[model samples]
Target: MAVGDPTVRTTPAVNETGEGTSTILQTRDLRKEFGGLTATDDVDLAVEESELRCLIGPNGAGKSTFLNLITGRLEPTAGSIYYDRFDITGLPSHERVDRGISMKFQVPSLYEEFTVRQNLRIPLQRAVESDVFEARTRELLDQFDLLTEIDEPATSLSHGQQQRLEIAMAMGLEPKLMLLDEPVAGLSVEETAEIADILQTIQAKEGVAFIVIEHDIDFVEMIADRVTVLDQGGIFTEGTIEEVTSNPDVKRIYLGEDD
Candidate 1:
């Protein structure tokens, strides 16, 4: 598809502040440390509203740590995080969710014994300030193609199905920005493609921005409008997928060879 093709539904408009739109999420010299080690080092990043930005790096590059900082799972040793112009550095994870930010972790987090519908109801109930929780829960199950398995125990579902269900749970919150941490991590190629299509559809319909951290380069290229490459806890480079993929330095450092 063409870049920013409305029909393809990958690229959406820039943010609301005109040409130079304000970021939906921004970090200034964000840092995290474990004793003498700097897990995330002076990282600066911004995610525009409705944009699907991918964060990719080798293992131990602090991708998850950076995500933890933003989601308030781990406190930053230094710097700040702003969401929608509000300083949310001190907010708890649930409060951040309340403020229209939600996340799906790399691992499928579900209530193993609970039926699919019951598992989904947890987030539905939490996001129930204005919308009807039950209706939203039903809608998500349908949207994610989990309606058939709604009555099955979460553990009884396939790995791919469980992944979809976890994401559906996050979507139950109707978030403005969603952080998907390896949403397709353990799925098969076909399963990954299915989830990717669902994500694109959701992005098109809802205009929900996302920061996806994934190791699968193909998967990232498929969904990312912009790619941020991290190395040793800092941003090594960032550009459109086309730019980053062809970059010599990116290839040498991350891909370990010329393309």
Candidate 2:
């Protein structure tokens, strides 16, 4: 499809003040380079409040580079990142988390030696008041459907269960924006569906925006409010799942089809 197809959505139009009123994250000319190679080109993107946006691309297309830049794992060589209307391009990763930005890497980050209850308490202890910490931990456990295994060691649970525990811990922070890198990377179909349901429910009830980098097309269709395709280190196209999936250019570039 043509780049400007009316049915296909592109970047949001910046207001006179240079930010969308509803946008939770915005990047201007975001770029990253290492040695002689440019991993991310000048890419301008915006994610709105409570939006479930998916980022997909072929390997070496710069999806990881862009995510690292947003989460402050890697500082951009050029451009600025704005979160909640403030410039956060130079902030450190931990500061970003403290400021309501959280990430769940592909590998689950759980305390393997701790019980489910103990793992959940790690983040809640730091964020919730002691008076309500126990109650809040229970709430998160129930939400993630881990109440039954609350006392089980992390290493004893199935892989999917461990993934759930990590997510529950991240939610303890009450983040405004959640960055998930291949959240359903390794799991049975049933487990993947459960993750999709949990994400949708949380977004609906909590109003947290999500920027997910995933290769699972089915899961992307299941959770994405919008889809962004990255190619050659920049945005190739973006639109609703249907519009993006049907675009000939996207299919050719993303699926490696040749004329």
Candidate 3:
């Protein structure tokens, strides 16, 4: 379906307590540190079944570190995380994936020498429990307009194409919550727009909630239903795009006065 099409139900909205009937993911006072430096500090966030939340911050603001802590790539120094109400703070990355959380990094991860179709097969193999693996893969390929490139070596695709491929692979898992870190990083304006369109389309149709970490305000504004800003490892401010953009403190600390 097209981006923002009302018919496709990707995720359910938050309930009365600002939580999903089935809270897909949650973090309570989550913190991460490296030696003397703190990367994430007391982060408390929640993602309902299919809510699209954008996390934005300046460089060194700990966006990546926070994502690592959630996905089990890095252990949190303190606090806890929950997936479907089950504690997952100590779970390994692979185990979390098996539990229904998937992440797509800013850098495209794929088998460069393998054809796009071959690259896709790896995830499909892992998704054996998914009844519609093949069909889902086909749909993802079509969604990204990469069906023709299925037979071409992944290394042969352009940077933009590679980005799309990585997203497609992540979607193949049918994740309950998708963590996308800078999915549009390094792409041209046009390329970013294309990827943005695909993301919007996926959310509308599949109800796959997303926690997108990005520096591109324009892009985040276009995709995020709500925006959260991080500064110096702490939540700086949060609100609608307009509210956050207009906040004087957010401007001074995160966006820069002139931004």
TM per candidate: 0.90, 0.90, 0.88
- Give the TM-score comparing model 2 with the true structure, all chains together: 0.90
lDDT of 3 by residue, 77-179 (tens): 9998877757788999999898778889976689888999888878777876557666766777999999988789998999989989998888877787899
Ranking under TM-score, best-scoring first?
Answer: 2, 1, 3
Q: Write the per-residue lDDT of candidate 1 for residues 1-259, one digit (tens) a residue.
A: 8865657532222222224455788887899999999999999898888889999888888899999998999999998787775778889998999889999998667999899989998888877744576677778999998998888999899999999999999898889999999988878899998988988988899999999999888898789989999999999999999999899988888888865
- Tens digits of per-residue lDDT, candidate 2, 47-163, equal 889999999999988998898898899999999888885688899998898889888887678888999999888878767788998788888889888989989899999988888
Give the true-structure RMSD of model 3.
7.8
Error of 2 at 98 (Å): 1.3
Runs with alpha carbons beyond 4 Å of true place in candidate 1: 1-20, 129-131
Give the per-residue Cα lDDT of candidate 1 at 60.
85
By lDDT, is 1 or 3 better? 1
Model 3: residue 128 alpha-carbon error in angstroms: 3.4
Number of backbone collisions per candidate: 0, 0, 4
Candidate 2 residues lying further than 4 Å off, grouped into runs, are 1-20, 256-259
What lDDT would candidate 2 get against the real structure?
0.87
The global Cα lDDT (0 to 1) of model 1 is 0.87
